[model samples]
Target: MNVAFFLIPKKDIVYLKEKSTMRQALERMEYHSYSAVPLIDNDGKYVGTITEGDLLWKLKNTPGLTFHNTEDIHLSEVEQHVQNLPVTIDAQIEDLISRAVVQNFVPVVDDQQTFIGIVRRREMIEYCSQLLLQRKVE
Candidate 1:
C-alpha cells in the first residue's frame, strides 16, 4: 500500500517548531495524546523527534526550571536520540510496520525532503485490525 494512505498528513500531525519551549512541546503532546512528536526547523525541514522520556529527562536534569526559563533552552539544545528510519512516500505496509515497531512513529518527508507527516503505531494497529476484519469477511 502507498505510505501516504497510512500516513497522518503533516496538517494532521502535532509537531513542534525548533524554537518552541519544552512546556509548549509538553502541552502539544498532551493535547494530541502522543508519546512523541516530530521536530521541524524554521524552513519546515524534518529535524528530529522528542519523546515523553526526553521531557522527563529535561525536567529531572534541570531542577527548578520553569516555563519562563525554558526560553534559554531550544529544542536543538536537548539531545534527541532519534532513529533515522527510512522515509519513502511509496513505503509498503510491511515496511511501515517494521519501522513503527522500532520507532513509535516514523517521520514522512516529501520528495524535497521537507517534513511532511508521520505514521503512528496506533494508526498502524488500527489499519491492521481493519485489514484483518475485511479479510475475515471475504
Candidate 2:
C-alpha cells in the first residue's frame, strides 16, 4: 500500500516554522499536548523535528534563560537531537516500518521536499495488527 494512504495531511496537523520563537513552539506543543512536532522552513520544506527534550536541553544549556525570555530565542537556536527521517509520497508501507519503529511519527515529504504531513506509528501498527488478525482468522 502507498504510504500516502496513511498520511495525516499537513492542514490537519500543527507544525512550526524555523523562524518561530521558542516560546511559540512551547505554547503550541503544550496546547496540543504533543511531545514533538515537525519543523518547516520559510518555504514550507521539512527541516527537522523539535522535541520536548530539545527544549529542556536548550533551557538547561542556556544560562539565565527563563520562560519569560523564551520569546527572544528562535526555534532555529534549539538543537534537534533526532533526525526524524522522512519518506517520499511514493514510498511503500514496507519502506516505513523501520522508521516507524524508532519515531513516534514519520514525516512525509513530497518530491520537492515540501512538508506534506505525517504517518503516525499508531496507524501503521494498527494496520499491521489487522492484517495479522485477518490471516489468523482465514
Candidate 3:
C-alpha cells in the first residue's frame, strides 16, 4: 500500500520554522502537549524533529541560559539529538514501517523535498493489525 494511506497532512499538523526561537518551540510543544514536533524551513522543506530532551539538554548545558533568555536563542541553536528521516511521497508501506519502528512519526516529503506530512506509527500498526485480522477471518 502507498504511504499516503497513513499520512496526516501538513495542514493539520503543528510544525516549527527554521527561524523560530527556542521559546517558540517550547510554547508550541507545551500547548500542543507533544513530546516531539517536525521542523521545517522557510522554503517549506523538512529539516528535522525536535524533542523535549533536546530542549532540556540545551537548557541544562548552556550556562546562564534561563527560560527568560530562551527568546534570544534561535531554534537552530538547539541541537537535534534525533534525526527523523523523511520518505518521499511515493514510498511504500514497508518503507514507512521500517522507519516508524524507530520514530514516533515518519516525515513525508515531495520530489522537491518540501515538507508534505507525516505517518504516525499508531495508524500503521492499526492498519497492519486489521490486515492480519482479515487474513485470519478468511
Candidate 4:
C-alpha cells in the first residue's frame, strides 16, 4: 500500500517550532500524549525530532537547570542532539513501517523537503491491525 493510504495528515500532526523552548516542547508532548514530536522551522520545514528520552536526558545532564528555567533554552539547541531520519510522502507503507520500527516515527516531507507530518508507530500498528482484521473477515 502507498504511504498516502496510511499517511497521518499534516493537520493531525503534533509539531513544534525550532525557536520554542524545551519546556514548551515537553508540555505539548505531555498534553498530546505523544512520546515524540516532529520539529519544524519558522518556514515550516521538517528539521528533526524530539523524544521524551531527549528531554529526560537534557534535564539530567544540564547541571543546576530546571525544566521551569528552560525557557531560555531554544528547541534548536536540543534538536542538535536528536536523531532525525528523512522520509518522503511517496514512500510505500512497508518502507514507512520499517523506518518506524527503528525510529518510532518517521517525518513526512513534501517534494521540496518541507515538514508535512509524521507516520507514527501506533498509527502503523493500527493500520496493520485493520488490514489483518479485514483479511480475516474475508
Which prediction has the highest lDDT against the true structure? 2
Model 3 misplacement above 4 A: none
Tens digits of per-residue lDDT for model 1 on 1-138? Answer: 778887788998688897888878877888888788888999988888888888778767887877667666777777776654648777778888888778888888887778889888888999999999999999
Better of 2 and 4 by lDDT: 2
| Cα lDDT of model 4 by residue, 38-94, tens digit | 888888898888888877878888898797798878878773455768678888887
Error of 1 at 57 (Å): 1.2
Per-residue lDDT over 23-125 for candidate 2, one digit per residue giving the tens place of the 0 to 100 score: 9999999999999999999999999999999999999999999999999999999999999999999999998999998999999999999999999999999
Residue 24 in model 4: shift from native, Å? 0.6
Best prediction by TM-score:
2
Clash numbers, per candidate: 0, 0, 0, 1
TM-score of each: 0.83, 0.98, 0.97, 0.85
Off by over 4 Å in 2: none
Report how far residue 89 has shifted in candidate 2, in Å. 0.2
- Cα lDDT for residue 13, candidate 1: 67
How many pairs of residues in model 3 come into backbone collision?
0
lDDT tens string, model 3, 53-91?
A: 999999999999999999998887899999999999999
Candidate 1's displacement at residue 23, Å, is 2.1
